[model samples]
Target: MADVATTVAPLVRRLLGGALPVRLEAWDGSHAGPDVPRGAEALIDDAAAETGHLTIVVRSPDALRRMLFAPGELGMARAYVAGDIDIDGDIFALLDLRHRLGAAGDHVRVGPSLTDIGAVVGILRRLGALGRPLPAPEEEQRRRGRRHSRRRDASAVRHHYDVGNDFYDLVLGPALTYSCAYWGDGVDDLETAQRAKHELVCRKLGLAEGMRVLDVGCGWGSFVIHAARHHGVDAVGITLSPEQADGARARVAEAGLEDRVEIRLQDYRDVTDPPFDAVASVGMFEHVGAAEADTYAAAMAALLVPGGRLLNHAISRPDPHADAGIHARSFIGRYVFPDSALHEVGQVVSALQGAGLEVRDLESLREHYARTLRAWVANLQGDWARAQRLVGPGRARTWRLYMAGSAVAFEAHRISVHQVLAVRPHADGTSAFPATREWLARPLVADGTGGAVGG
Candidate 1:
């Protein structure tokens, strides 16, 4: 029986090779890799040192075996998710190292190279007696049945949104609005910004007193309550998550607007009524898979009366060729938003037009979403202990990593959020929209107090 440290030392040696730019420390009190870059002396903590120093603590030898068996991103992800490996230094730098090692020509491919395969084989051959491969964490989702089907969509939505409303409350502020907020007009507070966002959507859709509005994928009834209480519209909100529907109904009742607001656990496709004067779908379009985008647009178009307005607010991937489904092997699909899909803005516009709706206005809220995510990250970090207790450590870590990464992506313009306003034209070929965008600039205050109306 050999000690674990002795078993892994040779593997680490072969893994780093001779010309090492990084330092690797093992949990067994053994060190490998060059003390410094191939040619330079070790500075206290220079940028190079920052990028090069990585502290890896292996909880179990099985972790290394699993990593070596699979290799590349999926293997690496499994090790982290299973709590077998921990990286103490910069995670992004480690990602960069992986990119550098896997680059081909001018492009960086996420797949492993032949060198990577050879290295894994060598590691396994030397330390094959350690342990057998372990199954991935129970958290990884593998939904069965047809994709985007009504029942399947409900399961997917519940998997993500039904993770305890208390957990969501800690992440989202008092308003509990999960979508990107409107941060314009010097609105610096989260609650205020969220209200401003709902107000902006109402103004864009031209909601008025007695006008009927349908809020698709309405989370917690934030927008529905806001529209009914603030915009004087008779609003109905629908969601696939039963928890959200319950919370939203309670919220509407609490707002004392039960006569004007209705929240249901219903699917967009199941919506049979079509007399709504205006419709708003915020943060919901992403759930409509690319394959279902046409159906979604057509459904919304049919729901609206002639000359009615529709506002589709959703996040979009800037890369034209990015997959609409969750990124390959990403944590978002495994733990966060299972079965979610994101479409490009152009694709969204085309779908709307194909559904017989004429595009009237388009606004990008990319930076606002970045700011909103940063706030959510701060809130989660602030209540880290409670979050872990609510959702367990693995799920909490998933949220932190994904939220921080999404904020960076939004700031870098790798992705964006857009509000696409289109209207069902009258027979006269007029959209009935104001000739100018001036109507949106007016401050329409339906309530004197600026606090959040309902849950």
Candidate 2:
């Protein structure tokens, strides 16, 4: 057969129903798509090109089999995660192609059209690349049992967050936050912006001295520590992951705030304490599943006292369709955030309101989340060696691919992260919330040296 790129180009272009936009290079030193520039190597692998220009490097014949067996996105992701494929010239450039693919629908999933299988089989046979299915990388998580049940949810949480505390610390830095950060104009580091984000939530919740607060799905207890130390609130942070709960408790103890902050290895549904003055759910409800969304909102509402505020911070899609949650078969579902689903802001508002909370304010921190993801990508890439050692190369590659792809999606508005502020009003309709949004933008600290947030 002709060289791999020569044989593969036209066929892929036909399956995609368009001309190829990215350069294709193969392990055998064959190339296709865009003309090779004067000085560049015939088979290029560099990752420094302009946006929208990229190279898909087929590193092994098994990459083709992986794609053949899984089809659509999963096949391609497995190839990438298993080191059979690599993207050259900026992962963003490659990810941008995801939306262009007819079946991808603008997310981490890379769904290239898989039609005309006879043609594909014919081509593969001629190229001597056809083979039976290979075992998926060990890192892929095969979800089992009933979805959204406490037992199943616990398993899913462990799949995503039980990798190791050290692994998260390496990626998330000292703030140990796993959500979007409140970025300041002059902020230069991830940890500082993370700290600002936690403090911002504290202010938004109207936290005050001696007030009781609850943090739902509190990853590593950063929010609880920040509120208790800086705002003097008595705080409870709860998470489903044992690893996260352990890490969060250690952090609270290390901060010398054990008396002020408590971290529990508990689910929000299990809490039966008296009403708290405020409640915050940061980046946690995505795992609540669309089917259990109402339950989640009701739980948060039940935890709050009348006139108490609740900050629901989580990722959302712009789609108005109630069923527009992430596909269960997508890359994120299988390998990254197992059983996670993104609800639109409208759905979230409805749930909160249906649970008897008034949505007071809505803010989209879409751009902030994009930047946060990129920072995490940078941290992972910079410490790639250590990361791979911590989580294995397959899992490490999965994180890199997901974060970079998510950055592209956020920049394009395909998905977003929102901070929805709601309050449980008194029977007579007193919200006790500030009439304006000014309170949310206060300086990070009283002295003002730490800089302003949400400004």
* lDDT of each residue in 222-335, candidate 1, tens digit only: 998888876688999999999999989988999898999988899999998778999999999988886899999999999999999999999987766777777535556666
Error of 2 at 224 (Å): 0.8
lDDT per residue, candidate 2, 1-455, as tens digits?
68888777766666445666668888899987666653322332232243455678888888778777787788888899999998776786667655445534437555344674566677678788788899999888887898888899899999999999999999988778999997777787787788878878877888889999999888898888888877889999889899999999888999899999988888788999959999999998889997898988888888889999999999998887646456666788788888888888999999999999999988899999999999998888889899999999999999999999899889888888899999999999998789888885556533344323321
Q: Which pairs of residues clash in candidate 2, taking residues 3 or more apart in a chain or in different chains?
A: 47-89
Per-model TM values vs. the true structure: 0.84, 0.92
Q: Candidate 1 local accuracy as lDDT?
A: 0.75
In candidate 1, what residue range of length 10 has the lowest lDDT sum? Answer: 103-112
For each of the candidates, the C-alpha root-mean-square deviation to the true structure, in angstroms, is 4.6, 3.3
> Model 1: which residue pairs collide?
none
lDDT of each: 0.75, 0.82
Stretches of candidate 2 exceeding 4 Å from the true structure = 12-21, 34-54, 103-108, 445-455
The lDDT, on a scale of 0 to 1, for candidate 2 is 0.82
